[model samples]
Target: MAFLELHGLTKTFGGVPAVDELNISVETGEFLSLLGPSGCGKTTTLNMIAGFLDPSAGNIRLNNAPLHTVKPRDRGLGVVFQSYALFPHMTVSENISFGLEILKVPQGEARRRVEDVIDLVRLAGMAHRFPAQLSGGQQQRVALARALVIEPPLLLLDEPLSNLDAKLRDDMQSELRRIQRSVGTTTIMVTHDQSEAMALSDRIAVMNQGRLEQAGSPQEVYDKPASAFVSGFLGKTNLLHGRLQRGGDGIGVIDIAAHRFRASDDQTCSPGPVKLSLRPEHIRIGKDAEDHACRVSGQIHSRVFLGDRWIYDVNCVLGTLLVYGQSGAAPFEDAETVSMSWDAAKLRIVEAGHA
Candidate 1:
């Protein structure tokens, strides 16, 4: 059995579903991220799992036992909210040891655990300081340490790093991953940031409009998105309307405007009107047409330099397509004609509309 399981888990408010029939299985010691935009039910799913909200219909199981029946405080799950939620009057040590105090752990053992977690989060010297005295990063560490001090079976983080600045958030992402790895804890984090989810999760379950759109590794979801919502949400991509014609050799040809592009026949779609998702980075600009399986001629409509890469909007025979060029490579100027090419395997047929 999976370490944690949610079968048809659901929630509703005012007769409208906030989370609908969501199912997920999490292995022991694995990190799974619930990722989506705001109001996409990611937070609601996390809340249901954390026992902060009751499920309208469904079962939550932990260790093959029913977990939904348990009260919030008795679930023994560590949760760090978006807000640190530390008691302003309590010192770091006091905050971390509070759970142990409630559990009636021996004073010596509680003190030792508190000290160990404090060191684990690298806040050894700041144990005596209150939340008001700590910086945003330090306070975040305190919240994380407090949650870890209990050593619960599951750790839940709801946008835990959202409050930190960009640099701090990056630093804390590394720190959080390291801490989770060292402890080998089963963790579920909820976040709206795609980059954050990609950087931190072993698997990502993307939600849209109270339903699960797709669940897979970062690369799997990015390369082969299940729907138009996922293809557009996970990263920058050009979604072009086309007509598909399946070939006999497990390959398909997509006709976009006046151009015909070859794509893999992996997706289950009729040979009719379809949507093709092509990542900007996959479309090579200024490449030799003789070296590629598919090629198109286009003129650069506009270009934007974003430090490490250049984004170009090219007006091709098909339409305006976005392409990415590495900063180290020569960039094309506006109105410059170039040959754009991509592998047939990189083009994907995605279902239209959101889930």
Candidate 2:
């Protein structure tokens, strides 16, 4: 059995569902991320799993036991909120030891656990400092340490790094993953940040409109999105309308405007109107086009250098398509005619519309 499972988990307010029939499973010691936009029910689902919200219909199971029946405080789960929620007057050691104290743990054991967690989170010397003395990243680590000190079966984080600046957030992502791995804790974090989810999760469950859009490993979800909403949500992609035409040799042709693009035939859909998802990095430009199966001519309408890469908007007979090129190489200038090509295997057939 899965370590944590949500079967038909649902929640409603005023007769409207905030989370509807959501089903997902997390393995023991695995890191799963609930990812979606604001009000998409990712947070709502996390709240339900953490026992803060009751499911209107459906059930939650942990280790084959009913979790919905348990009260929030009695559930034995650790939660770290986005705000950190550290008390101002308490020292770092006190804040981390609070949970153990509540559980009536002996003073000696609590002190030992607090000290170990402080070292684990790299706050050894800062144990005497209050929340006001810590930086954003340090405060985040303290929140995490407090949650870990209790040694709960499950750890829940609600956008825990959202408040940090870009560099600090990036640094903490590595730290969080390291800490979780070192302790081998099963964790579930809710975040709207796509890169964060991809960076930190063993699996990502994307929610939309109170329903699960898709759930898979980061590479699987990115390279083979289940829907247009997922493709657009996960990263930059050129979404175009096309008509699928099945060919005899197990290949299919997509008709986009006057251009013909070949794609591998999965035979999941009949020849009909379809939506194509092609990532910008997948589309090769200039001499890089020589090896690809599908080729087209376009003019670079605009280009923006983003340190690590250059994003180009290329206008072709079909439409405007986005392309990404590495910054180390020379980039095509604006209005320059260029050849764009991509392998047939790189094209993805996604569900129509943004749902």
Candidate 3:
């Protein structure tokens, strides 16, 4: 059995379901991310795991023991919030030691543990500083240290880096990963930022509305999205609607307005209906076609220069498609006809849905 498990978990408010029939397992010492947009149930699921909100249905288990009946303090879980919920008057050391003190741990032991966490979070030198005296990142570190000082069996972080500036957030992402690995605590983090989840998680559980859309390694989820929504949500995608034609080689082909493209045969679609997803970077555009497969000729409708790359809106007979290429590669004038191509293997076949 996994260290943390949630079975058929759900939460409802005023006749509406915020989280529905969600099930997931987290291995001990693994870092998992609950990732989705706002109101997508990521925070609700975290709250349920932390014992703050009782589930409308199902069970939460920690270390194979039922946790729903236990009080939040007795659940052996630590949570860090987006708003650095620190005691303004207390020093960093006192803040981290508060949980231990409330639990009646020996004074010496509490001090020792506080020192350990302060060092772990790299706040050793700021131990005597109040929350207001620290930077945003430092204050957030104090919050994390406070959570981990209790030596909880599981750690939950709710967008702990959201308040920091972009550069500090990036730095803290790496720091948090290091801290988790060193401590080997089972962790679940809730975040709406896809890049942050990709950077920190061993696996990510992507939620939508109230259901888990997909769960897998970052590469698995990004390179092989299970549905159109998953593809469009994780990153930019060029969606094309078409009919399916099974080739003799077991690959499936999609018939766009004026082009036929091949995708892997992993899709469960009827021969008459299908949808294909392509990433903008996956599409290559140039005139020098020495040797390549799946090429298409189109007219360049618009081009914009973005740092490190150029974004071209192409008007192909199939429809308008976006293509991204490295800067200074080739220049195509507006209304000028051009050829675009992409690797057949890069095309992802999904069940037919709205374009």
Instruction: Candidate 1: list runs displaced more than 4 Å.
Output: 248-250, 287-290, 352-355
Query: Each candidate's root-mean-square deviation in Å?
Result: 1.8, 1.7, 1.8
Off by over 4 Å in 2: 265-267, 287-291, 352-355
Candidate 3 per-residue C-alpha lDDT over 156-200 given as tens digits, one digit per residue, 9 for 90 to 100: 999989999999999999999999999998999999999999999
Please give the lDDT score for candidate 1: 0.91
Model 3 bad stretches (over 4 Å) = 248-250, 328-333, 353-355
Q: What does candidate 2's lDDT look like per residue over 142-241, in tens digits?
A: 9999999999999999999999999999999999999999999999999999999999999999999999999999999999998889999999999888
| Alpha carbon deviation, residue 199, candidate 1 (Å) | 0.4
For each candidate, what TM-score against the reference? 0.96, 0.97, 0.94
Q: Give the worst 10-residue stretch by lDDT in candidate 2.
A: 346-355
lDDT of 1 by residue, 210-308 (tens): 999999999999999998899999999998888887667767788788677776756567778887789999988884555766888889999999999
Candidate 1 at residue 117, lDDT? 95
Clashing pairs in 1: none
Model 3 error, position 62 (Å): 1.2
